[model samples]
Structures are given as structure tokens and as C-alpha cells.
Target: MISDPDGTVLALFAAFCRIGGCIMVLPGFSSARISLQIRILLAVAVSMAMLPVLWDQIYPQVTGKGHSYLLLVTFETVIGVVFGLITRYYVLGLQFAGTVLTMMIGFNAPPTADVLEDTAENQLTNMISFAGLLILFLMDFHHVVFSALVDSYTSMPIGAKFDPQNVLITLTNTLSQTFFIMLRLASPYILYGLLFNIAVGFVNKLAPAIPIYFISTPYLIAGGMFLVYFGIAAMLKLFADGFGPILRGL
Candidate 1:
């Protein structure tokens, strides 16, 4: 009855190494704000739980020689990281859109705190990041990570050998989609800002006498604030819609 405990344990450790590495970089689990210990513990728990169910399926496929477990382990890690990064890239789209929207509306205030580690980002950008993270949790996408992990095992088999070309293609495709989604989300703000700036420019051109520069800045800010307050609800809905597709695509 499989009495080779040492071999079995080694195989299990190898599998855990792959899973744990993936989780550390995974979207929901890999938050920059979260503690490292928590992340490691969570990965360990998940790997332990899934190992028995997955070992038979994954072990046979991964053929290799001694000490070169590094290659197999590396391949598994890359697969996991790629899967997680795809989802994260989309969420970053949400943040990028929010930053653009805020800049257009004149709310480009300096950031108050350290966001996503030591990076001091703009306030509006931070809000969108936080809000998007919150929404992801609210919608329970974290559970889907497990589903994605399972699918990865099937999509990229353990011993199938890593394909850098395909991985790069996938990442490039995801990044492109992220840029498109960000522009789409912030399109309304772009239009509003554009029109407002044009009108103000015309006024300044027409009446060179009235100190237009000083007065118009505040007016633009106020108008932008008003528009954003009303439109934020709609913007969030759009984010949710776009995020859903991106997650599914991943």
C-alpha cells in the first residue's frame, strides 16, 4: 500500500512548493497590504488540502530526473503566477481608469498614505484600487481562484514543458485588454473635461481683460466634482461589468 513515505512526502512537498508560490502572487491573496505570514499560511493550507486530490493527476504527467525538480517546480510556479497576474492586470485597469477620471475632473490631490506597499500614489487612484478590491471580495471572486488553479492544472499540465511564447502572448493580450478597459471606463470624464476646457479657452480668448485663468480653475474643479458625484455610481457598475468578463477570460 505505497509504503515509501519518503518519496510520497517529497512529491507532496514539490507540489506544495508550486501551489504556494502561485498563491503568493495570486490576485486576491497577493495583496501588497497583507502580511507575508498570512499569505504563506494560507498557501500552505490550500496546497495541503488540494495535494491528495491532485497528486495522482499531476504527478504522473511531470517526468523528470533528480535535483532538476527545480525545473518542474519553476514551471509550476510560472503557470501559477501567470494565472494570478491576468486577474490582477484587469483590476489595475480599474485603478488606472479612476486616476484618469479624477485628473480630468480636477481632483488630482496628492496621495495621503502608502498604497500597495511603499508607493505613494494619487488619492483618486488609491480609492479606485481599494474599491475594486472591495468589490472583488464582495462578489466572491476569491473562491474562483481555486477553480482557476484547478483549470490551470488541466490547461497547462505538470510535465508538458513550459512554453514561453504562449505565456508571453497571454500576458501581452491581457495587458492590451487592461488598457482598453481603462480608457472605456474613463471615457465619459474625458469628454466632459475636454468640453469644459474648450469652453474656458474660448472665454479667455474672447475676453483677455478679465483674469480668466484664476477664476476658471475653481469653476472647472467645481463642475468636475459635481459631474463625478453623479457619475460615480454608474462608473462602479461599469467596473463590475468589465471586471466580470476579465475574470472569466482569465
Candidate 2:
């Protein structure tokens, strides 16, 4: 019954190019553990739901541009990916912090399959990343992401020319901010590891024949575990709170 069904279809496809691209890299939604079909379906569902809300911004752009459809699709996907990666990179900061924490705290666990990605990761790293991501989910980070995507139409409209230099700057700034925030989150462990190692080193120097470093390994891990027990809740809380402001600022 719709008079311009072709136009509507084109608009929907254009919407998918952005929403689908965002979901393709979204943290919880885009996990390797999720089946490809499920991700695709989720993206499609989200795009369909978003179509009406974003119709004014998206529909007119694609309705009559048959020859430029490919170009529009490509740019829209790139814009979505850029936005998705903003959050993705922030989540990845937890992994980076975890890696540092494990090394500093002397927690040596064998590498295992990462819960989020297919790569192998230290058990401690996996635990931290999983916990952080789980907490973010509990905090409804995805809703915030979708909201931001909706707002992006105003900030980064469809068909906007892709500027590689600006894109590079944005990515670099996201990474820089992510790194600083991660450093702050993991600083306690870094300091703990440093002071503990320094004291252990002095002990080893005093008792060179006793393999004191090996002797202290158990204590080091025990202390780190204790710290995690008390601090993880606060750490994840900070991470979740920071996501919205930092991403919106970017």
C-alpha cells in the first residue's frame, strides 16, 4: 500500500549500513561467541526499529541516488564503525589494564580462550575483562551506545565526506583517553607490584642464596587477589560511569 516502497527499502538499507556496522563491532553484541546469523539479525532488527526515528536524516539522502548508493553505503558504514570503535576501544582498555595487572602482581595462570575474542589470554586478564564487560552490560551500556548513535545523525550526518585526517585524529584521541583512564584504573596494582617487587628485591639481595623471589611469588599473588577482591567493584563502577561522558565528549 506504500506508494514509494522502493524509496523506503533504500532508506532501510542505508540505515542498516550504519546500525549494522555499529553492531558489527559493538562489545557485547559483537562477541566472537555470538553466531554470525544472530549478529546479523540483531543488526537488522535494530536498524528496523531505528529507521523511523532516523528517517528524516537518512531517507531523503538515499531515495533518488541510485548511482551513489554504493558510496553512501560505504560512508555510512565507516561512520558507524568509527562510532562503535569509540566504545570498543574504551572496553579494550580493561583488557590492557588486566594484562598489566597480571604481570605486575605475579599472577601466573596459563593462557586460555578469551571470553570476548578468540585469542588466548591470561586467566587473570580474561577474568578482569569479563567482569568489566559484564558490569557494563548491567549498567546498560548498549542503550547508551544506541542513544549516541541516534545523536550521531546530528553530529555526523549521513553522506558527510570522510576526512581521513580528522578520522585519524579522533581515533588517536580516543586511544589516548582510553590509555589514561586505564592507567588510572590499574594504577593501584601498578604501585602495589612496584613496591612489593622493590621490597622483595631488597630481601633477595639480603639473602642471595635462598631464592627469595620464588618464595615471594605466593605472597605476591595472594596480595593481588586480596586487592582485586576489594577493588574490582569500584574499578568496574568507574569504568561504567566514564563510558558515557568520554564517548559523548568525543
Candidate 3:
């Protein structure tokens, strides 16, 4: 039996619309700093590539109910956005951690206009965020993202009812996890900073005549830089080990 060309195109386009809009806002890929032309190209590339795999699964489920189709497409877009948001949380975790670290490190740069969100993250954020992305790449975590996109069609069916409560719960849980992971990942620096501050404070108290401010600033700066430098392997290792589990959780 031959399918109606219009119906097939509609189904195909509906699926494409969701996937295209998703990759546009998807973390790592989503950046206004990147040219619109490039984003469109990426959207098209991902949309076309995903269509074949997802179409058979999603097409049958699409009822093609006149204007109801727009509602369905909107739901699809929401699902896509939710998926991107959930998956993007890990990147946001790094940014959050970087933001806190920037404050500690005295790098109070404004969040860029092209940033993914209104995070008050600083210039060191650029470093930490880039480092996080780089670590994700090195750990091959994008494979998990691609696999999750394919898996999402089956997990979240077309025209399925979404629970707003569950969405809120998921977001809350994700933010909590992000903050925890940020502290965990940067524990080395946090530990160093804490101990250094305590010790320096004591030394100043014991030696009231000495300007520990002059003495301690260079030590903390040098020590913090040293720890951050030596800590790359640990950070990347954490990324490698945790990313698969995080993707699976998402």
C-alpha cells in the first residue's frame, strides 16, 4: 500500500521540527555566539539524520488530526526542550561550579550576552566550561547524547500526556545534583582553599606584627593555581567516569 505523499511529508516534518529545534537549544551545540547559518546547518543535519530512525517509531503514533497537529508539534517541541534541558544540566553543573570558583578566585567577570543562560559565571567560567566540554568530548559522552535522542522517541511517545509535577521534580532534582556535583568536582580546590584560609588566619593571629595579608596572598594564589593545574587529570577522569552514569540517569 502506497502512503499519501502529503501525510508522509507532514509526519516527517513534524519529527524533524522537534529534533531540529532540540539540537538548536541543546547544550554544547546551542550557542548564540555561533552564527545563525551554522546553527541552521547543524539543525538540518541533525534533523535529517534523526528523521529516518525516529520516523518509523513516531510516524505511526502521529494521528494527523488537522490543526491538532500543531498542538502535537508543540508537545513534541516541549519534549525536545525538556530533553535538552535535562541533558544540559551536566554542563550547567560545571558552569555553576565554575561560577562559585570564580567568586572564590576573585574573577568577577559578567556573564556573556551569548551565554546559554543568565548565569553570573565569570571569565574563569569560560575556562571551566570549555574544560568541561573538552572533557566530555575526550570521554566520548556525545555518544550517550546521540543514543539518548534515539531512545527518547520510545521513552516519550508522540501525543503522550506529560506530568507537570514530574517535570518540576526532575528540574529540582537536576539542580540539586548539579550543585552537589560542582562541589564534588571542585572539592580539591575547595579543600585547598579552606585549609589555606584557616592556616593563614591562624598564622596572622599568632604573629600579630607580621602582615600575613602580604605573605598569604601569593601563597594562596600560587597554591590554587598549582592545584588547578595538577587537578586536570582528576577532573577529566571524573568526567569520563561519571558522564555515562549521568546520561543513563537522564
Candidate 4:
């Protein structure tokens, strides 16, 4: 019943180069906790599902293309990785923000195994990162990424010349925007840390004989924790809100 099975296979692989590339570095899906087999199956399934809709676009470009087909695969995979990096960078920004918050609040608990990855991370950082990621999933952020991928075919079609300059510019802009957003989220804590340390310094000066550093640490951590309890909702909301504009800018 199937016609041109060879061409169909070529087209499917071409599509996989892009979609699978994205999934390879995608946030939740790319976690170290996920087995490689699962990621491969996921990429293949998504490639197949998207193939029908993209048949007219992908099939013609790949079928019977000789050596040029290899070029197409390379460019396609690069484009996919670029798209995945955009989202990945944004999520990593949240992790950076979490680390900043932890230090600011004086929450120097020993680093523990990260909930989502094999790396060790502060408990506070892990909580903030996981919570931000969970909120994004709840809000269906993957759907947005997939939509962007579908739209990318229109913008950067198969066999199109790869533009490293544009890719660099896009990534640079993403980092700039992510840094600004994360800074805003962590600013209050930064301020808290600065002021808290200053006050403690003054107290230590006043009571030189007292173990002021030892006495003040618990209060510093408690105050920071209180701020986190009150401000975490807003922080996550801001983080989630920034994801859309960043992706759309791409």
C-alpha cells in the first residue's frame, strides 16, 4: 500500500534530525534521569507524527538528493539544536537565579544530589529550579516549543543555507534577556543579603567580644527563608512569563 518507501524513510530521517536534535537538549526530556532509549523513541515518535503534516515540505527536499542530502541533515540538526538551546538556556538561567538566591539568603546547606540531574546542587537551588520547571510543564511550555519547531520549517526550510551569524545573535540575545530577567527575580534577595550583612557587621563592631558572626547566621537564614516563602510565587510567575517572549523572539 505504501508508495516510495525509500523516499518516505529518507524524509522521516530528515525530519528526525531536527525534532530529535531539539529533544536531545530539551529541558525535562533531556534530563540525565531519562534513559537514552526513551529519548530516541520519543524523538522517532514525534518525527513520525509530524511527518504527515510536513510531508510536502520535507519529502521533496530529501528524496533522491545524493550527497547534498548529507548537508541538509547537518543543517537541519544544527537548526534543531539551536532551537533546543534557546529553551535550555532560559531554564538554566532559572538555575543560576536559584544559586544566587541561595547565597543571598545565607542558606549554605551542604549540596545534595539534584532532583533532576546527576549533579550536586544546594537544596534551595534544587527546589527553586524544580519548582520553576514544574510550573512550566503545568503551563504546557513544551507545546509552545513544538509549535515553534513547526513554524521553523517555514522560516528555515530544509536545504537552506545555515546562518551561523544569525544563530550567534539569537543566542546572545537570549542570554542577555535571560540575565536581565533573572537579575530582576534575584534583586530583592541580593539587596537583602547586602543589608543583612551590613547590619550584622555593625552589630559585631558594637559587641566585639560576642560571637556575633555565629549568633547572626541563624537569623540571616531565617529572614531569607521568610522572604523566599513570601516571594517564591512571584519569582516563578516571572520566570514562566519570560519563556514565551524569549522563544517568540527566536
lDDT of each: 0.76, 0.88, 0.70, 0.92
RMSD values for the candidates in order, in angstroms, are: 2.1, 1.4, 3.1, 1.0
TM-score between candidate 1 and the true structure: 0.91
Instruction: Please rank every candidate by lDDT, starting with the best.
Output: 4, 2, 1, 3
Sorting all predicted structures by TM-score, with the top scorer first, yields 4, 2, 1, 3
Cα deviation of 167, candidate 1, in Å: 0.8
TM-score of 3: 0.84
Q: Per-residue lDDT for 49 in model 3?
A: 78
- Strongest candidate by TM-score: 4
**Best lDDT among the predictions, by candidate number:** 4
Pairs clashing within candidate 3? none
TM-scores, each model vs. reference: 0.91, 0.95, 0.84, 0.97
User: Lowest summed lDDT over 10 consecutive residues: which window, candidate 2?
Assistant: 241-250
- Write the residue-wise lDDT of candidate 4 on 156-233 in tens digits: 988778899999999999999999999999999999999999999999899999999899899999999999999999
Error of 3 at 186 (Å): 1.4
lDDT of 3: 0.70
**Candidate 3 lDDT, 1-250, residue by residue in tens:** 5367776677777776666666766676776567778877876677767777777776676655787778888877776666677667878777767666655543445666435444444556677777777777776665666677678777777777766787677777777766676788877777777788889889999999999878777777777667677876787577556656566555
Candidate 4: Cα lDDT at 233 = 96
Candidate 1 overall lDDT versus native: 0.76
Candidate 2 clashes between residue pairs 3 or more apart in a chain or in different chains: none
